[model samples]
Target: MQSTSHSAVLGRRKEPHTIIIARGDAVRHFTIRPWVATLLVCCVAVIAAGYLLATTYLVLRDDLIGASVAWQARMQQAYEDRIATLRSQIDRITSRQLLDQQLMEQKVNELIERQTALTERQNVIAPIVERVNTAPTGEESERIEKKPQLGTVSPDQSGFKASQIAALWKTRTESLNKTPAEKADLAFSTITKSLRHVEDDQLKRLESLADDAYQTADKISQALASAGLVIDVDYDKANVGGPLIEIDKSQVFDTRVRELNAAFRMLDTVKDQARSLPVANPAPGRPVSSSFGVRRDPIIGTAALHSGMDFRTGTGTPIRATASGTVVSAGWSGGYGRMVEVEHGQGFTTRYAHMSEILVVPGEKIERGMIVGKTGSSGRSTGPHLHYEVRKNGTALDPLRFITAGRQIQSYL
Candidate 1:
């Protein structure tokens, strides 16, 4: 009986440990009563295995994350480098100084504005590419350049065709992450093709515009040349490349037009001014000492504003009308011996003071620069000098301002 019981105990122990892994009751329902304590030991082994598996996965996850971050950083750096290069190129092109100073500045301003627009475009497009690599396959990227059915391609033809030339060569951006690898390749290739197309179109247009500009400039320049205006055909130094690409003739001709107009304006202004006034010199040898306004007062103390310029001409120098007008007054006036006043319209008048002799009577019409009398020390009696005065609305104006170059005033004594 003892041997049989011992054998039974061994057999019971040998049976697979029945550790209750399922629950049946509210409490520890299926209580795992270790037949021989082996059942409890089995539970511990399973827990240990699970802990080891979880730890391994955590370590792997950290390493994968590190690599992904590194990739993203590198991509960002590359993109930045490209943007910087483009900006540099744009800057160089915009700073040209060869054209007309004013026009060049305007063009540079325009170029800077366009470059800013292009930069904004790049900023909008760059992030979309990065997100594509992280988006799941079959994902629709929010950044994809979906074109409206504005072209010849039908809706069915418009759908993405990884193998089609047009689809693979254009509309190549994606907004999703975890996208299929093939799509990325396709997107990049298409983008490259698209960029080349754009660059080519722009280059051709630039060339065409430049050609057109040259033709227009040349034509207008010929016209200006015939019209006696010279064109300045030059490019700015700061602008890159061999020449400026453009299509505007007014760019050059306008400058010449402005210059010509300015020159004519100056001539017109000069002609409008009265320079030589009429007066006679009583003394023949004394040159004009002082013309008008404050002098040494011939006897004052402080520096005073000289109202008119002086003409150092020999006495008896003949004086004439500075302009054509009617003599409004001819008589002796205080500090003015036998003076004559002439009125030139628009509220302007000329006065010849201290005249040795008044040749023209009051109300007499006189020609410009006409000899009016001899220079004399008749009034205020200083040596002979015509105290000629120009007045606009009765206010004394400068006589020198009207004096024409190379023409001396007077014919007296």
Candidate 2:
């Protein structure tokens, strides 16, 4: 049965089909085998499948390419954005660092200028302080135990020297994670504060010195008034001028200095006046035989006005000039025989009367304590004595007033 089925399949496959076609009187015949037909069908099917597959590929190619291009663009944009962000961050950091540096430099420069200004102020204040320290203060002299050495700012006191600031900066930078500019800024601020303190100290010193000078001048004035001598001091206007600059009231150092200088000038003027006044006793360590006023006349034995104080001393005792002056009259003058009159300036004069001998001639310049004559009872007197008279502009004044004032003012001088 298998052989029969196989023979049948083979016979069908070997069978040929014939087709005849006639056009007009001519005819044509064609024969086709089953195997050939099957082969042709296979070739047609293969060609159709290949065409369909090619068409499908052509339809999807554009979408695939578009997706791939989109993905690549996204990746490139992401990379670019990341790079831009990093660049911005780096720029910000760099800019911040530069700004910090500039600020630090500005602060440091300001500190340096302030320090220089303080140094200049010290220069002006040093001499003024020295003058105040050396000035006579009478009983208060003990209070001024020592004079400070000026013109140098102690770093330990102020804590603002350049080297110290640098050291501080280094120490802070090592301890902190801060940048160099930040550390520098901190150091500069510290220095500025210290310099401000120094400035304040200088101002205070100047103020104190100025007050002392003015007080000294006032004391001299008061002392002169006590002696019944009112002296006027005129201070010359200082030739000071400068370019206009805005200054606050707190910065009055220059004003203080000017005031101190004026005080010194006034003190000098008063001192000169005091020196010219007759204030010393002509015969020191001698007893006063007769007081200045109405007294009994030794020779006449009656009450009379005694124009001067009489000092009892042996004849030929040395008599000294009470003040520096010129010998205006050194010759005999009737009752004031062998008299020596000294003309001290400021309308003051001294007369040494009843002298046994005149040591200075008229028109001779003499200083205080100079031996101007010898004591004797040469003018309407009955004993060896010296008559000392203090006159102001030809008018007699109490000699005791000047003598007392001199004693009080001696310490100041």
Candidate 3:
């Protein structure tokens, strides 16, 4: 009987547990396995952790956004405060020692504006001056380099010669015992005169640079024309129209700068065109076996029109493209075996003939000095050589003109 009672107790322990909810005369029961209860607790813990992580992410995001906005506002305010301080300094320098303070303020402000404009002009002129100093057109840059004043000063230091002017004015005005108004006017007059001298010097230097640029452009234009090609110097202009107003004499420096900039643009266009010309030798250090013109045919022994120059080279010597262009034709042709023809724009084309091996194919882009083929006498019976030709608008041109121009450009480059 005792054993039977012990077995009943063990069976109760193995069965699932019941969770009971009790109220006055009302009761409910929920049966669950121990493993199910454990799973429920774990799910509640996971949800609570997720909620905390999401809340943290939202709080941190708000903080970061607020910080970014505050940073921008701070920077903007700093810039405004700095600008205000500079204006206040200008006012203190102008209105501190004059009876007619209002009138002197206006005049001094105008002079300050002029000085500021001159200072900005100095920054613009600096690069142009440096370019002139370094430009390959030899002696002009040499002379400019010798002039110590042409080198650029710091932007703030340019045309702000207040201390020097103040000292000189104090000496001259102290003896006369000038009135405050007169003293202020005289001081401003001296500043204006000083700024004018600097502006005039800058204008003269720019004029000199513009003249030199135009001269270089002119020489390049002439050289190109000799090869029967003309470069269009007038690049496209931007759309611009405005109501005309009376010109201000104060704007003379700016107006001249605009004109000089326009001249430099033309010079740049000319230089680009010059670069595209066939101005490089196909086989450097090679002797010309035959010149372009009527020449005695090697096999037939009769005068024939030779449309190109022939450079004497050994078999398999490298032959390079004279200018950057696209290969218009390549491969074997009658009388000119294994030829590569390149079309450089502006109606100019170049041909390499008698090549034993063509390294480029039709429609391939080639850059200047790229090896296009190997030189060999493959057609019309001759020793190993490279036959090079320059043509414009389908008419053969003398290659010597281009070769000579190349030499001239090299001298400067």
Candidate 4:
């Protein structure tokens, strides 16, 4: 059993081993690690085990924690989605509300601005109207509320913002469950409402004015009623003429029906005002150098009473008619050489003197603003100027008395 075993030594030499590898478009030489396969296998097994565990969990969790966890995840997802949706909706609502508010604010601001403009207009018109013998009251008590109408809107309020309009629509909907598209219709409605509400107050004012006018008419009627003049109320005709044109018959009767009648009867006197003179001058722009009252005479250098104004104008300046009327006198007068007299309607008469040229003939029909003659120092004057005078029924009056400023008169007066 004891046998000598002969051992054969295996020759071993340390050497580097090179491996060749090839890929598309490239070649390389490398050395391979001995444990690479084992490591790869370990990684693959781990992955497989993890997948198996997940699969098992899904299958087994059909009853307890797994299913509950899945359900909770779904619920959380749903909650997130819902939150996103609500946030989007809230943004939309907020945007809409903001837009609406802006529009409404714009409307309010413009409306207030328009109110101011209207107030300014009232100021201008009131002064002009005041100078008239009888003017309608612009007070809330006297003004009739026009029907709500588009035209009545303050100019500044014409364009309303969409948001504001939307808010207004909502309010209108709540008020009557309806809305209107036509601005004019809305305006008309508003005006009508205002007019109706102010009826009593306006009526009282109208009554007061009517009473005053009546008193004026009565007084006029007593003195001038015999002048073949009539101041009767006639809807068919206006004393001034035109549709809706009203005549203050009450005042005509109370103040001076006869005077009015005489004024009207002096049809020839009125005809004179509109006459075109030989030179078409009407004394409309004639400037006043001397006043109508007592003044020192420029030539005499002494205190003297003056009955008229001296209108200083360039030679040949056009004179115009103050009112529509006929030519009463176109000839020269004592101390008022080369004079023309026009009798304007409305109990008004004007005289132009020292005219270098006369463009109109006597008994000529003329309208207000017609040129009658050219300015010149033909009468008693120191320089090239026209002696101008205004008279009401043979009574001299200050020419400035008729110049009235008002919104109504801004365009003409």
Number of the top-ranking candidate, with lDDT as the measure: 3
Worst 10 residues of 4 by lDDT: 404-413
Q: TM-score for model 3? A: 0.60
Candidate 1 structure lDDT: 0.52
Residue 123, candidate 3: Cα error in Å is 3.1
Summing lDDT over every window of 10 consecutive residues in candidate 3, give the lowest-scoring window: 148-157
Tens digit of per-residue lDDT, candidate 2, span 1-413: 98889887776444578888999998998897788889999999999999998898899889889999999999999999999999999999999878877876777778778777777777777776667567646743654444323443454556567778888778776748766666666667667766776676666555655565556556766777897977665454356667998777555767766776776677777777767778777898898888878887887789998888889999999998888899998989999888999999878899999999999999999987899989998877788899899998898887777777776776666
In model 4, the runs with Cα more than 4 Å from the true position are: 1-287, 404-413
Task: Arrange candidates, best lDDT first.
Answer: 3, 2, 4, 1
lDDT of 1 at 132: 27
| TM-score of every model versus the real structure | 0.30, 0.62, 0.60, 0.37
lDDT, each prediction = 0.52, 0.78, 0.80, 0.57
Error of 3 at 404 (Å): 2.2
> lDDT tens digits, residues 44-144, model 1?
88888888889888979888898999999999999999999999887776553233345545645655654564455344323423332244222123212
lDDT (C-alpha) at residue 105 in model 3: 75
Model 1, stretches more than 4 Å misplaced? 1-288, 291-293, 299-315, 404-413
Tens digits of per-residue lDDT for model 3 on 1-413?
98789888776447788989999789998999999999999999999999898888887988889899999999999999999999998887766645377777788788889878877887888776666555555654565655434323434435557667887667796837987667777788877876776777677667766676677777777766676657665453456668989778777677767867877887877776776789889999999988999989888889999898999989999999988899999999878888999999979999999899999999999988899999988876468899899998999988988888876664333
Model 2 residue runs over 4 Å out of place are 1-90, 133-190, 233-247, 281-289, 311-321, 331-338, 354-360, 366-386
What lDDT does candidate 3 reach at residue 51? 89
- Least well predicted 10-residue stretch by lDDT in candidate 2: 143-152
Could you tell me the lDDT of residue 309 within candidate 3? 93
